[model samples]
Target: SGTAVLTPREPGGLPHGLRAAIALRAAAAVQDEELMAHYRARLEACPGGVSFATFAVPGTMPEDTRLAAILRHADLLTVEPRGATRDDIEGLKAADVTEPDIVRLAELCAFLAYQARLLMGLRLLRNA
Candidate 1:
């Protein structure tokens, strides 16, 4: 079910490679080796995935304007979603991201948050 978010039937402006990179970034934020490994494999399977290697790292930023904007939003979504403001959406718009793509990104981030929490809870239950 969650895999569909990364590889949707209609990917729109966000390609599978970019989606995997963003997922990898979110997974890295939570320091989950298991999640990171999953996303890494998904990324590696994507075309042009190697170009997105830097994004998987926590502090690295992309030189491309659009990618930078997306990365910024991903970082914000991962680290402090509550801090996100209209300015962030405006930033994406300024970078030429379409409205639908913006929605796609938000959904991806939201899904990652849910996935992380669910994994953590399962781990806790297993340990218990």
Candidate 2:
């Protein structure tokens, strides 16, 4: 069973840098300090990877169209999923994002949300 497919911890289908960026961005969107630190450290350790400023600060990142699409897609999926529509998807496609890659992005976004909720539940359940 050494498939090494996509997992919350493993950057299987996507590049490790993008995976780390998305994970860190998701954690930042949700204000999950623990996860933020975890992914930030991982990303920073990546050779020639984008820094936090690229993702966190507005209008500071370089001309990274791919990362822009991924970040915007992750934001919509994480922050306002109900508001997401085909247009949102078309936007990614317009930015040259592949369908399979989009699916992987969705998987990553969904998993982050799931992990955050599970962590919150555990914290609450522990306190109860």
lDDT against the true structure, each candidate = 0.90, 0.71
**Model 1, runs deviating above 4 Å:** none
Assess candidate 2 and give its TM-score to the true structure: 0.78
Output the number of the lDDT-best candidate. 1
The model with the greatest TM-score is 1
Query: Per model, how many backbone clashes are there?
Result: 0, 0
Q: Write the per-residue lDDT of candidate 1 for residues 47-88, one digit (tens) a residue.
A: 888878778888788788998888899899989999999999
Screening candidate 2 with a backbone cut-off below 3 angstroms (N, C-alpha, C), the clashing residue pairs are none
- Candidate 1 yields a Cα-based lDDT of 0.90
Candidate 1: Cα lDDT at 42: 86
User: In candidate 2, what residue range of length 10 has the lowest lDDT sum?
Assistant: 1-10
